[model samples]
Target chain A: MTLLSALDYASVAVFALTGALVASRAQLDIVGFIFVACLTALGGGTLRDAILNRDMVFWVADPVMLAVAGSAAVTVFFSAHLLESRYRALLWLDACALAVAVPAGVGVAMGMGSAWPIVIVMGMITGCMGGLMRDVVCNEVPLVLKQGELYVTAAFAGAVAAVVAATFGLETGIALLICAAVTVTLRAGSLALGWRLPVYRARPPRNGPRN
Target chain B: MTLLSALDYASVAVFALTGALVASRAQLDIVGFIFVACLTALGGGTLRDAILNRDMVFWVADPVMLAVAGSAAVTVFFSAHLLESRYRALLWLDACALAVAVPAGVGVAMGMGSAWPIVIVMGMITGCMGGLMRDVVCNEVPLVLKQGELYVTAAFAGAVAAVVAATFGLETGIALLICAAVTVTLRAGSLALGWRLPVYRARPPRNGPRN
Candidate 1:
């Protein structure tokens, strides 16, 4: 529980940083910056909870979460101009976010007793969807949907590992550690090796219906 | 059933057309145009069905509905250039969309056995959420949320009327007609009279933690 709590805070902090980066790129005002940051931090979990029909979402249940995310956003907004290395900082923050978030999402879904495949899918979605939404709103091609590092695939692998370890009678704590290790390693490996999914563009159909 | 089908078709068509118009303004390519149109036509229903856990969404179950929406978008995209009064055309199209969509949403929710209040909420959400999403994606402020012509209010009033009439033993067809009429009339009245919701500004917090 302590380890999960730490990872949760790390994930939220990194996500807040990424959100601030996006808002800065868009040249948004302070209000827009906070709005985007909170959205990026809570959006994926909110969708997941809504889909699962949970009684109350994590942010809604605990106001402290919102406060922490908001504070992180404000801190980054004021301090971002002082940073010397921009792209490298953004990349490192995003990688750290993926490392922490994938396992957390998988852990929560597994705790909910979702089927293994569904758990894996949910983890991938939860880990990546918020960033994808932010990119869409920021008018960028979604990084995951483009030829990028194996982001969603890494989440899937981690979630599957966690589920499989649990099926082999591992303790929940041990399983979470394994999940986090798998997620971080796979994602970091992809970043180091420039690993990417194959881009399979749909071929225009012959004699396609005319517009 | 026949009237419901007609209304559904009309709503989907006009909504798709509106989306295509926005896509033009956004300078999206052909694929983006089609995607946005599809999102506008089916997005609300998809959210509703997903929330309700309904099996197989309507467009997924019936591809012809998508075809109709696609054709409507294509027609509007091409014909828009020929219109001398595009803004007027857009206003009328929006009015038509509201008239058809509000009652159709209420009818669908009630048919699926949702309680009165839930049905009313669903109706408003279904009628408004897609356009809100469309505007947000296009980077425009959401018209439904603005202090402008009473879109959600009209939807709510129509849905309540339909549910009340049904509760009082009115025929389903007549009830739907009354609901549709209420929505259309309310929307038309708001546009003519410049009716609007009061503006909402955030109030200063007392004794709140400051960052």
Candidate 2:
């Protein structure tokens, strides 16, 4: 497989793990586990592809990805109780998935001759969509919409990196690698150091809106 | 415009109103108003088109639906509090939109040569996705997903009406009208009469799984 496609699969698998863990916490059945896992793994890519008007949904076009995500869900369902800290694992796996998904989205848009801004936007969508869908389906306030979440920002930065590097005539492979690296660094840093964007505080009614 | 397209626009406007009311309750600013409104209006069509691999997203390809939704949002923003009961308005409007959207979705899938089951599924998706998205974003458990909720069931019945009528050689227009009538009757009746399906009872631990 191409490096980009490989990155896509890896990202999906990690994301599926996060989704299954959430389903388990909700005490959902095996069907819910698979459904959530597959949605989390493929939701972002599906949205990106549809918005970009790609011909087919990523997972629907390739059932192997669905199978892979299903396998991840099954594994997590059976073994989650054995894990020391599924929450921590979820955060780290999500971070890794975000790192890889950014370049995957950017690459697809870039390949389709999308403009730089659209490329970056698509990249961020790809990286954030899985978790957004997961939280939404599970009836939690989506983390992406929360005031202090740095996750979307990190994905945006990584997308911009790939777009900028490509503009400077970097090879596609090298540019994507830089994209993934920057994303992983930022996300991992956020987890390790409790980094956050400034929260948008609802100020006194007399004051203007939060930035 | 075709009848289906017209139904699409009408449903989008109504659904946007529901979304804007939710945003108003959350006390979001105008930007949030617009965002939530557009999402509520278009989320169902977007999901249906994406899953069906249609050539273009209904709203994205035609900016008119977005404009309609935006106009609805603005209207709700300014006048929501003036309404005697926004929640009641939301539920009724949502029911109406669901009625129209079911036929719209089933028509599109049928036009694309989808099987009857897929057509029914798509119809329900079209009917429910907007509200599902609105509730999720607004952090309310989706009404369609609530125990014994008749919302999705109503949509499904409408879709089945269209497919069955068409199967027996009904004209497209009549078939769609039949679909809409059935859906509206069931949904409106439920709202008026408090009709609901039986909630699945959880058996004792001697049985295998919950419900």
**Candidate 1 lDDT over residue span A1-211, tens digit each:** 5666666666777787888777666555454455457657766766776676665555545556666777877777676665555445666677677777777777677778988887777677667877776676656567666575777777778888888998999986688778778877877787778777777667766887634
Off by over 4 Å in 2: A1-43, A50-124, A137-140, A147-211, B147-149, B201-211
The whole-model lDDT of each prediction reads 0.71, 0.83
TM-score of chain A of 2: 0.93
Clashes of each: 0, 0
Q: Put down candidate 2 lDDT per residue, A102-133, tens digits, no spaces.
A: 99999988888876766876787799878888
Off by over 4 Å in 1: A1-46, A49-108, A115-211, B28-32, B202-211
By TM-score, who's the top model here?
2
TM-score of 1: 0.56
Share of true Cα-Cα contacts across chains kept by each model: 0.03, 0.11
- What TM-score, to 2 decimal places, does chain A of model 1 have? 0.87
Per-residue CA lDDT of model 1 for B1-211, tens digit only, reads 5877777888888888877877777777777777888888887777666655566777888788898878877787677778776656765666678777777777787887766755765576577767767887788655554344566667768888999999999987888889888988887777777765442222232433211
Candidate 2 Cα lDDT to native: 0.83
